[model samples]
Target: MSTDVAIIGLGIHPFGRTPDRTGLQQCAIAVSDALKEANVAWNAVDFAFGGSTDAGNADTLVSELGLTGIPFMNVANGCATGGSALAAACNTIRSGAGKLGLVCGFDKHARGAFKVNPKEWGLGNWYGEEGFALTTQFFAMKIQRYMHDYGITEVALARVAEKAFRNGALNPNAWRKTPISIDEILTSQMVNDPLRKYMFCSPSEGAVALLVCPASDAEKYTKTPIFVASCLMRTRRFGTLEVFSPSKAIEDQKTVTQDASKVAYEEAGIGPGDIDVAQIQDTESGAEIMHMAENGLCEDGEQEHMLARGETDLNGRLPINTDGGCIANGEPIGASGLRQVHELCLQLRGTAGNRQVKASPKTGYAQVYGAPGVSGVTILNS
Candidate 1:
């Protein structure tokens, strides 16, 4: 039986490079802060789920939080790690496995572009050596095709990046805190055909944790507990094009994000128009532009117009990625999805400070798309 869930507490570590700290330390800070805010002891948490990459097993956090012998599961699903963890926790709770649970995501990787080992995914070693599996190339090719079909321009892409950096300047946890102009982004070095260096999100380190329980009991913890209207995940179908797909077949197949979002909106009894704010995957400016349409936030060819009119700015019709997004916060893989949720939690709670959307946002939406074709979406209300 599905159950109603409420987020009683949320915690996040500043997103950026930190050479001096270990993944465990960062996760500990986030978890401790979450527990303290929830007013729930670590031992009181009935179950736990976490994700990580290059940071070893997530349950290793037991060393820092003390061994409580709870059923802590580890998850790793490329960039959807955190979202998968949340799905597990929420399902476990809904199935009556537990009422109170903890979900954590953390990662720390070396400075540089992420390397794809095709052999790990069953491809030949030559695929890796020749850079045929590079994600940057996939983004460039996809965006080029999108622009060709939808009339999107390089300026539109630059505008998205410009907005991201400008929003990042208001986010204390953002990695790239300085804002840049559209001209600066256009003139930046090109990493691929159409994707410039400034247009892409950098890989970095960070951690985020959430405390969830039945909404009936949320008032015991906080008066402003955010309710989880829906949380869902989806994988690509046969005709879907993805970051590491073998083909870019343009067929009648719908994207995983589109499907997941449709289910989420239905379950929540709401539509995109009902959402007041959002935090979508912006691994690059192009991804953000495409996702705006894919997630049903707008029409296919409306991004160019919406972006040009500042319709997506902080004070615009629908403020999005108000906390800098991946472009400014950096992508920490396992930690990224939860970071989006954390930012929305702050916005709904009216505690987002400098980056808060005006006019009092009552509903929020978040979506995360990952490599090899996977997507996760969540809807929340205050």
Candidate 2:
């Protein structure tokens, strides 16, 4: 069965370290704001889908809100947690299970790089024992290879980070509002080879929530409803290479973002050329450059020219991460993908205040990639 879902409401709390608040507390604020914006009541929500890495039992949120006895499932898909949960909620409505539902994600990360057990992703103990499990190392290695193969300069990487911080300065919800120049980024403390401290996104705290219903009923909630044209999620193919993998793919390799984007465009009946704005995985500056190609927004090696020509800026041909992506807002695990959804929704509705893209774009795309080679893509139209 096929049905259109409308995102009538979206809410995101300020993204940064919130030492005073609990994960549930942050979620409560986001959900409350979303319900108010959607003009929806807690009891009216049929179900909820969401999860958090550091925060426990997402379903326990019912205690903070009302115990309406709705089905709330906990979803854990690493960094793509929010996208996966939103997909489940959309599927629930499309399958005739319910009309109105909630999709929420929140996370409170500790200081330092995100550390995980190697056994979780089928890695051997040597990874955990020898300290080869850090995600930054993987990002560095992958981008280093990409730059070498594509002849991308170190300045190109710095350019992406500079743009991210510049955009972040305009977003009140962003964690790092102070803008930095390409020179600053290039000279920042080196975390991994070719990646500086400013280039990497920190594990921060944030929460985001969306209220969705069938498109037919969206008018009842909001005048400018953002329709979810397509939502697709995919895991790694056999030859795909990603963070946490020990070996690299030699041939016939396609990244999960590429395959999932193909499905998203097919389902939406649109191509990359149709997208006016986008938000992709930017775990670091290089990730954005690589994802631009992987998501089919541009061909390989085109990013060098795009960055130089200001083609990806707010007033350029296609604006990305207009509301300060992971690079500025910081990655909140479960909430990261939903944050992208919120930013795109604002753009499609022409409500992205200071960072609003020109030309009044009618379509927007969002993609999120996580560890162990998982990707989720969503297309939104006004």
Candidate 3:
């Protein structure tokens, strides 16, 4: 028998700009919503895992939810944090170590951008400052190099933003619902060179929770439970500094997204052509296009052409970021990965409402990647 795990229930706090709640409070609300959706009592859960970065204490978030006597752990992997937590929960269920596990991810950007602790290197001018500086500057460098090497135009980036905003208009939970034109994105203020203010993700507060269980218990809860076909996680073994080197060889090897997708496709017994729907980490518009090519959805450098031809729209061959992705939905740090999963779950269950794709989505993939080259890919099947 296959030791497959299934998602019994899933819940998501509205993805928008909300300042009233802290990250912990957002997590508690999501957890309660998921339990109610799953028809499972909070006390009956066997384990709980919280994913976050700057959300105060991880354990405190669970405690605030009135959770006790369950093995609780925290997960932090930059943007891939929530995906990592969900993967761990699936592993536990597959191992028969737990009957029901709750994976919760939340983030409140009201506290401001999460900065890296400079004290970790112990003073006196390290090679680089940690935290938000590295994240913003590192991706900035990559974007510059990509534009230079590929001869990509500014119009390409604008098209990416336009596509995401168009999709976001249909997502009631998205932060930016108004559709933007290519001209508007091009004229937007530049945050990092070549990356405009409209290109980067907006910070917001939100939470997402999932109830995972063994395949045996799926029917007890949900009529439309989605199976966890595969879960894959990878880290940059050579470190981010290598990519910054002035060597052609090193630059060619800086394809972590492609590598992770290869592993996930093998484990799931499928390929990119088999995927009916997908949610990719689009912290910036460039990332959305780059990931599509890197994940084999199209040939390398073909994403721009795909977008120009309207092949990635909601009614196109392969609908991407149907929930507006991190671009329109806002990146809530730890809650991002789970939000992607939640969107995929909704697609598979036919509950996506107005934002639903017309394709018969039998399988879907959700990928979350971070600045340090950490990535997680979860494949779900209906």
Evaluate all candidate structures by whole-model CA lDDT and list the values in order. 0.89, 0.92, 0.80
The candidate with the higher TM-score, 1 or 3, is: 1
Highest TM-score scorer: 2
Candidate 1 — which pairs collide?
none
Task: Summarize candidate 2's per-residue lDDT along 1-382 as a digit string, tens digits.
Answer: 1339999888888999888998879988999999999898999999899899997778999999999999999999999999899999999999989899889999998989997889998999998888889899988998999999998999999889999999999999999999998888989999999899999999999999999999999999999899998997999898877889888768858899999999999999989999999999999999999999999999999999999998999999989888878999999999999999999999988888999998999889999999988999999999
TM-score of each: 0.98, 0.98, 0.92
Error of 3 at 351 (Å): 1.0
In model 2, the runs with Cα more than 4 Å from the true position are 1-3
Q: What is the TM-score of candidate 3?
A: 0.92
Q: Which ten residues in a row have the lowest lDDT in candidate 2?
A: 1-10
**Deviating ranges (above 4 Å) for candidate 3:** 1-3, 110-114, 118-132, 239-251
- Superposed Cα deviation of residue 257, candidate 3 (Å): 1.9
Model 1 alpha-carbon drift over 4 Å, by segment:
1-3
